[model samples]
Target: MKTVADIILHNGNIQTQDGFHPMARAVAVSGKRILSVGSDRDILGLASSHTQVIDLDNRLVLPGFIDTHFHFYEWALNYDSIDFSRVGSFKEMENAVSNKALALGEGNWVLGQGFNESDWPENKIPDRYDLDRIAPNNPVCIWRCDLHLSVANSLGLKLAKIGFETPDPEDGVIAKDTSGRPTGVLKELASNLIRNVLPKPSRAAVLENMQKAVGDAHKFGLTSIHDIRLMGGLDGADALKAWQQLHRENRLHIRCHVALPGEMTDQAIDLGLCTGFGDDLLKIGYLKFFSDGGMGARTGWMTKKYLDAEFGMPLTPVADIERAVLKADQVGLSVMVHAVGDRANKEIIAMFQRIESHDRTRCIIPHRIEHVQMILPEDLEKLSTLKNIAVSCQPNNLSLDISMIDSCAGPRGKYAYALKNILKTGVPLMLSSDAPVADPNPLAGIYSAVTRKRMNKTPEKGWYVEQALSVEEAVKGYTITPAVASGTGDCLGSISKGKIADIIVLDQDIFKIDPDGIADTKVDITLFDGRIVHER
Candidate 1:
């Protein structure tokens, strides 16, 4: 006889993205899998005398949220670092760094994330002298909100040996003053100059951070996340190794779809790691490539010059990115390129057009152009063609990029977050908070998609109200679309029978709430594999 396992959730409005059951009252779980879902009485009848039954008390239950893109490692390491998440003035930032340095003592590295020059009134990137004046002996590194840029103090530059003679790396830039001296700021590849010199964290530290990040994800009601960047350099692949350790220990609570950086695309291909190389806990989803830099960093490849500036270059040239995409497709590995500008998206689409198969597995499996921010009107159609190409959009960008749009895009800023336009073209859409840059709050992200308003709540309606999505469409992007993007749509997207028992019970009916209030809603309970992981 088959031994029955424990637990079942009954009496709730289960919104299974599966459509068949728009609302289910109960669900049965055996061990880690969902055994059945139906009426309250039907599911409760499956419970053995030993089964644990949970009454949801009419709270709305749905598939656990899945973040299609995020940097889990970075988020974890930042917990101990200085937080500039809310610091407004440069004085405030300096004070924060000084305080952190005092706490850590002299000579300690004072690091922080979420410092956006655009957010400052002066719209200027701070330099080494600013920190050198505060913490003269400490090495301080403050990452720009986009993570594509970092401003280090004089001490940090000295610690990393970054001097005037330091030639710019092929793909990165070290900002220089008008006098051609190092300006204590680095962009993109240039960031590695300091990171490479810094001592790598211990394996124990990596594990600890990984656990903390995972726990945080669970509390946010995320049962799955696609670790966006997993590239390792001279450190001997610590990121991959740490993830494997977490998987082996069964400590990785949520499903993880990891990406191998473009630098290691060859290695991933040689190892025969396709889209689904591992079990539920870990899998090789795609090979990530950078076609252009990020938006806030002003490095995103643009066809025409930026409205305010004449200088901007693609991280990878048009020819090179296309060639890499074609080669990755030929090798049976899916490709995902970060293309934020209209030109970058067009160039990536042109490259994807070369892929010649309808087979999702062999040809071009769900190739993604991450952050299709300023997509061209004409090129939107290309998304529907090309066998496996989806737009992995970051809708929360509207909240963060509002100031940038006014300063950078000037008149063309209207197209910043075009969710409605993108979706209407019949392209599959997935939503994510590029965290540490934006809050990983799915509700906030969803609210942004539907409303397109920033923190100040301007625009009355939205930047491009015609492109705004419906509440249901936006929610589907967070739940169903992400699962589909990760190749787990059948098992994880919805609250359905025989699916993974990962679900979230929200405090209010998401659909019934005011559109603007959606972001304010709370997660009452989060469950993973039928086990309660977080409860308010």
Candidate 2:
């Protein structure tokens, strides 16, 4: 009996991202997986008259992108929020919020995200007073691009119970004015004061947004993501429930490895759930915990003081985090801790060293550090030496942090986003968008990794030029590296026989194009689980 392919893509340049078969001209898909991949002639032989054949026209074809770290659920639910991702000035941010408030009418909460005052001409973060001046009637709260800082209007502050007399939460700060009144600018945990009070999006709203988000992601050629539960993670159990329900209904097209919070280790263990449990469409991932805050908020746990500021702070100190790691490891759940500063990474590495000392590869899955962004030159090798530890770095964050790294980190910024050195050690370097914090598009991330430059390609020579990675290396970070991290290496990540049929065809061959053009790259067509989901 001859096996027939359900669909076939031929006449194109295909980068397999697989070491075994580095390139191919055609690929055939049957059901939910790749049936064959070879030259056009070879693949065409496997296709029957019923096969849906797509001609690539000498374009670029690659495995769909996989974002290793993402706040996908939250990003989706907040889809209608005013996006400040590219707003250039504080005044512009205010105008955007005012417009949203007017559009939504008065009395309703006007939620928005992605405002970076650091990139503005004035270089000053917006304050509550500014938001009040623009949207006095509607309560407004907008997040900084980093998501670690937020500014709220007077009405928003009142709703969240934040006032002049309110003290900052532990491991967080409330910016105050000269007269010692609360400025309505909250950092880290302080921002949660507002988030906790805001009305949660209904279950229907979340599911709808999830579908819309995946549809939009397909346009960017994204096939998979690790949906990180943070900023009120697990949403008191609603988040995971929604994901599982979607999977059950066969409504989810994007592969997801939904991560839980570290504190939920007890609940996970109680349910006898281990990391990597569940079907391919949805799986349980590592337990996520914040070892420190973002550098943009000046709360990253750095050893030395930031320029003109005090030393950074860690949200969960070493001792506390170690306890959580040990508990999770004992229950067979892998850990993923966010560590951006040198001190934070060092502390996490030390904890893992101790955990592995008790048993080699203690957890079923390898432990990982998210955003191992800023590190000392001497400490660079420590992360790679841990065989079971992976580093998930967001190169796109580098584009946003290039100027901030230099201005705030001073001379210590030399080793920021050390991609070249990290790859040299042969440790798994997973690339991601950390979406809503940055563009979820993996091409933007790949461009930043390959060029080490901002969106406009400023600085001509690129920032930290020595830390740049090649185009292939960057693709692996977004593809195979994340696939392997999710325990899908055997089935996903590459356009090879037996792999899941998640593929994307590009309008242009990114390999032959200029480094800057990588960001402008667009997906011409996308196929997921052998089904055509997008074509542009």
- TM-score, each model? 0.95, 0.97
Of candidate 2, the 10-residue stretch with the lowest lDDT total is: 230-239
- Compared with the true structure, model 2 gives a TM-score of 0.97
lDDT of 1 by residue, 451-527 (tens): 88875566677676777888889889989887776577778888877788888988888788777777887888888
Error of 2 at 443 (Å): 0.6
Stretches > 4 Å off in candidate 2: 232-236, 360-362
lDDT tens per residue, model 2, 1-536: 13799998999899999998999999988998898889999999988779999888889999989998898988998988988888888788878888998999999999988877777888998788788899999998988888888888899999998887888888789889988878888989898899888887777888999999999999999989898877446363777898988988889899888889877778888898778888878888888888888888888888888995777788877788788788778767888999988888888888887877777444757888899888776667766667777889999998888878888987678778999998887778999999989999999999999999999898799987999999999999988887886678888898888888999999877788999999999999988887889999
Model 1 ranges off by over 4 Å:
1-5, 230-236, 357-364, 456-460
Cα RMSD for candidates in order: 2.2, 1.4
Best candidate, TM-score: 2
